[model samples]
Target: MKTLLETLGFLALVQGAMGLLHEFTDWHVGLVQRVGLLDGHEVYASVALIVLAIALFAAAERCEAD
Candidate 1:
């Protein structure tokens, strides 16, 4: 379970980085513009990634404690 959590956390971090890049470059603008939801997608993904990373770090600490 700990390993799984770590993996998920890593994935989330990577995804968040990508999302940020997209936002910076307006890479996803075309898609979001079509759907009319581009204004806040990056912020949401970034927050989610940060939460996932924190959760994984906490899980890792717990595993080490055990």
Candidate 2:
């Protein structure tokens, strides 16, 4: 479970980075653009995903310490 959480966190972090890139840079990914979150606020969705990634990482660390 800990490993799974860590993997998920890592994936989310990557996704958030992609989203940020898609939003700020000329590079655009259709998948991230189609999220339809916050009425097309990709930045919000990306930030949310980043927050989730952090939480998942923290949870994984806590599990390991237990």
Candidate 3:
């Protein structure tokens, strides 16, 4: 259980970081533009959701452990 929690925490951190980069930098947008979906606001919203989900999952895991 401890290992599972730790792994989840790490995954959450990685996902959150990716989301942050996507939202705050142009690098991700450039990539998205190349993929031809750049005009869609849904992509950005999904990234935001990923960040929020990771944060909430991590928090929940910690609380459960405690």
Candidate 4:
């Protein structure tokens, strides 16, 4: 469970950062922009992802080691 949370948190952080990066610069990377549903909501999604990552990290920190 700890390892899973950490992995998910790391992935979320990366994807969120990538989304924001793609939005600000000409790098044009990440799945956020490619989603048809997101459209102009890429930034929001990115921010949400970052928030999720933070929460996941917190949860992982609280988890007991097996």
Tell me how far the alpha carbon of residue 30 in candidate 1 is from the true structure, in angstroms, after superposition. 14
- Residue 26 of model 1 has an lDDT of 68
Regions of candidate 3 where Cα sits further than 4 Å from its true position: 29-66
- The CA lDDT of each predicted structure is 0.68, 0.84, 0.56, 0.94
Query: What is candidate 2's local distance difference test score?
Result: 0.84
**Candidate 1: lDDT over CA atoms?**
0.68
Predicted structure 2, TM vs. truth: 0.86
Off by over 4 Å in 1: 27-39
The TM-score-based order of candidates, best leading, equals: 4, 2, 1, 3
lDDT of 3 by residue, 28-54 (tens): 633333434545564564465466656
* Residues 1-66 of candidate 2: C-alpha lDDT, one tens digit per residue: 899999999988888888888888858753566665555788888888899999999999999999
Which order, best to worst by lDDT? 4, 2, 1, 3
Poorest 10 consecutive residues of model 4 by lDDT?
57-66
Task: For model 3, name the residue pairs that clash.
Answer: none
TM-score winner among the candidates? Answer: 4
TM-scores of all candidate predictions against the true structure:
0.65, 0.86, 0.43, 0.93
